[model samples]
Target: MPRFHLVSDPDDPVVAPFRAIKERDLVGREGLFIAEGETVLRAFTRDAPQRVVSLLIDPKRREKLADVFAGLPEFTPIYLAEQGVLDAIAGFHLHRGILAVGRKPPAVAARDLLASLPARAMVLVLCGIANHDNMGGIYRNAAAFGADAIVLDADCCDPLYRKAIRVSVGAVLSVPTARLSRDESIADLLDATGFEGLALSPSADEILATLKPAARTAVLLGTEGPGLSPDVMARARRIGIPMANSFDSLNVATTSGIVLHHLRFLGG
Candidate 1:
């Protein structure tokens, strides 16, 4: 069993890893990311434990976290600390009272991911989604909608960003996500895989509810302000969510959820 440490001060040497989480430079130096809350931390470890470096939990909550930690390798470290100490050390109070430090793993590759998905899979392709919260929300929606994979264009934000992970409630780990980086490349790949590129835009002529979902579908999304690039939109079939008001374009995440729900499960 990995021994748990009791840290009582913000200045404790043991707290360095926790403090580095918010600092990009420091996180890069240490090659670690901080996962907060019991649910997220448990999900992360359950999915990939070898990458877990250490865990910090409030002394009061140790028992509750013990069951999850029990199955982890004996080499993993679990630390227990007073609430004050954890709060000070983390540079902010972690209400969840538990946080885990883990290494960032390599991202999935688009080609490999596509090849692995089933023929009838539904994929969400984000063209330039730059918001972390939106990215996380989309991932949550993707999982809820039973999407097989998520594809990002070059301009998209990092799905593994701390805020993204938090907003996603760690659903990012549950879904397969990869970057495509180029419109042409993505179009070619979709064509080759027999997946139709269906663009989701407010300017689209066709309503989402009207069209039948394809066996292999790629729902192309764009950024909040500008939406999809013309070049990218040109290669894909245009479809829009039917709305009551003209100015009522939903947030990219909300739109994605609505579209995914309608296109993936509802269509079939």
Candidate 2:
């Protein structure tokens, strides 16, 4: 069984792994992530079932979390502490009253994630999307809107970053994601997969409305300021959401949500 220990200080050895996750290069490695808050913790337990490694929660929250922990593997640790102790050891006030660390699960290739879908699918490809909040928001929307999968191009921030995981409310764990080590590899993968790589930009004459819904599409987005890289734009067919004001461009996450919703409900 996973070890359960009471911690009196923030520097407790048990908390070291949580602190290290902030600066670690965990992607594509065998390690895992730290997920905080009751919502995220419960979600992880629900989705993974047998994968949760350890859970540190305020003793008061245990009754609430019991259903989430039932029928899991015997080694899964459900560590409990006083509210004050839990908060102090976490290095912050407990917002959701719980935190858990899970081992990284095996990942699928970018091509495989898309190919597994049976019908025309709208997937998201992020190029240089460095903001964890933006990535999280995008992932939340992707899951809500039925996007097939998410692909991160080179130079993007880690999807498993603590802020990203919290912002995503642990939705990143449920959605399939693949990170390409190089930007060129993403373009090559998309081309080889027969996905219509459509770059979302304000400069394009073609809008989401102009496209047919039946087409298998991959929407490529970038950060708010620089937008999609020139190289990525070259590889993608230029398309816009057709805003009324000439000066306004939707935030990348907002644009992604709108586009995904349109595809999900309107098939456009």
Cα deviation in Å at residue 95, candidate 2? 3.7
Candidate 1 error regions (>4 Å): 9-14, 25-31, 182-184
Per-residue alpha-carbon lDDT of model 1 for 1-268, expressed as tens digits?
Answer: 8787777777878767777456653345345677788778777877777878888889899888777888678968787888888887777767888888778767767878887888788998887788888998999898787889898888887777777878888877778878875544777778777888998777778888888878888888887678877766889989877678566578889988888888765778
Clash totals in order:
0, 0
Query: Candidate 2, 33: how far from true, in Å?
Result: 0.7
Cα lDDT tens digits, model 2, 201-258, are: 7778877875665477888888878887776788788877776756567778888888
List ranges where model 2 is wrong by over 4 Å. 1-16, 19-30
Clashing pairs for model 2 are none
What C-alpha lDDT does candidate 2 achieve relative to the native structure?
Answer: 0.75
Which model scores highest in TM-score?
1
Q: What TM-score, to 2 decimals, does candidate 2 have?
A: 0.87
Which clashing pairs does model 1 show?
A: none
